[model samples]
Target: MHAFTVIRTYLRLGLLNFVQYRADFFLGVVNAAIQFAIQLLAISIVFNQTDSLKGWSRADLIVLVGVHAIVSGILGTVFSPSIGAFLESIRLGTFDFLLTKPVDAQLLASVQSVAPQSLTSLLAGIVIIVYGLQTGSGFPGFGSVVIFVGLLIAGLMMVYSFMMVLASLAFWFVKLDNIMNIFNTMFGNAGTWPITIFPGWLRVTLTFIIPIAFAVTIPAQALIGSLTLANALLTAALAVLFVAASRWFWLFAVKHYTGASA
Candidate 1:
């Protein structure tokens, strides 16, 4: 309960800070709009060439785009900013202050910063998802909606765990901006399509090594009605495993963290 309260307080402060800078919020909206437009144009051009890309219809692909936006929005809104701040703090030797807090260091570090402006993508993604559902496959039933939400949560969990593992690398490699860039490049370009379109070996790598396929593709399958019970089970299992492993890795990194004093 205390943790939840602290999270809420941090979120409120973040939102308040975002609103304080009206110009920044508008810039964020404009940036997000331009990016969203380009993605739509690309999707349209792809459909112009072929009716279906690897068995996924244009509408289905639209949902995939929305999923990507939503996932990206969430990352930007909280995790990305927080991770960036954490890394900066570590570099500046200010992370010692965070470690001294009564709360869990991981929890505090994860929610320390927020970018409410990034929510533009999240809201826009919802609009795109609704439009896609209207155009293709119709609306999923209540059960499917429940399942999709579950899978979406699972997808977010996997992505967060992956990022955390990467962030943990900062304990040794303090300058790791390139790592986040690599994830963004791969996820942004590849997550727009069905993972099935990839070659077998690459698919295995994305699903297990990088684990991005589980982040965007699997939950998308749930929404499009292609997700099977077995796949859902696998997603749940992997989510647990990723989270646990990331936590362990984080602790190991902390053990070696030699604070600002060092």
Candidate 2:
């Protein structure tokens, strides 16, 4: 089958599987609500003690929080779960079936799992973003809007590539599961504050090494009309680089997998 056909089939099976557990849907809604409330309360507490945070006013920070929530929702919904399943497939040898298929391996891994529960987070994030836009001025005109969307797309791609690289490591180290827990912790914190709040060293790490800033902070900056031309260009360039690097790494990992299994 073609890649598109496989993707459609995978998505259908994922949806059906999620539908089998109906109660979990409501549970997911509750989880998203609690998460949103906690994030908003944290923002409120921070703003109460100070008028601004790291050059961001109350409204600006709220918008940042909203953007963070949206991004968090997206990551939890698709990138997180899909990659987790991919790693598991590798460990269990199910990945061999994927390698033998006609479609792209990464594409197959990515579209294989779609948790229905993540929809709750996605909806919550959209609501928060919309609320932030309504309250904050300077919503950005046409050019800025285009740039914001581009940055968001690039940001998502960068994050997925990074996660794929980590998942590919499972081919060599099955016990790497615990390490991904560390990634989850880092991901949770990345959306809580602007990268500017980090120390110089940490900021550099976030920007160039892990590139968390590209995933969350840079996109938030774009929304607030603060992203510089340099940052914008850098994000685009990094997105391209990460994609190529991830493909190369996955191919290398695939060779390792084949050799190990053989």
Clashes of each: 0, 0
Runs off by more than 4 Å, candidate 1 = none
Error of 2 at 259 (Å): 5.5
- Candidate 2 lDDT, 102-174, residue by residue in tens: 7888887887777767778767766776677677765667787688779888988887888889888988887
Per-candidate TM-score against the hidden true structure: 0.97, 0.92
Per residue, candidate 1 scores C-alpha lDDT tens digits across 1-262 of 3899988989999999987887887888899889889998999999999999988999998988888888888989999899999999988999999988888999988999999998988888888888888999898888988888888888888888999999999999998999888987988788777888899999998888777778888888878888889989999999999999999999999999999889
Q: RMSD of candidate 2 to the true fold?
A: 1.9
State the weakest 10-residue window (summed lDDT) of model 2.
253-262
TM-score of candidate 1 to 2 decimals = 0.97
Residue 249 displacement in candidate 2 (angstroms): 0.8
> What do the candidate models score in CA lDDT, each in turn?
0.88, 0.79
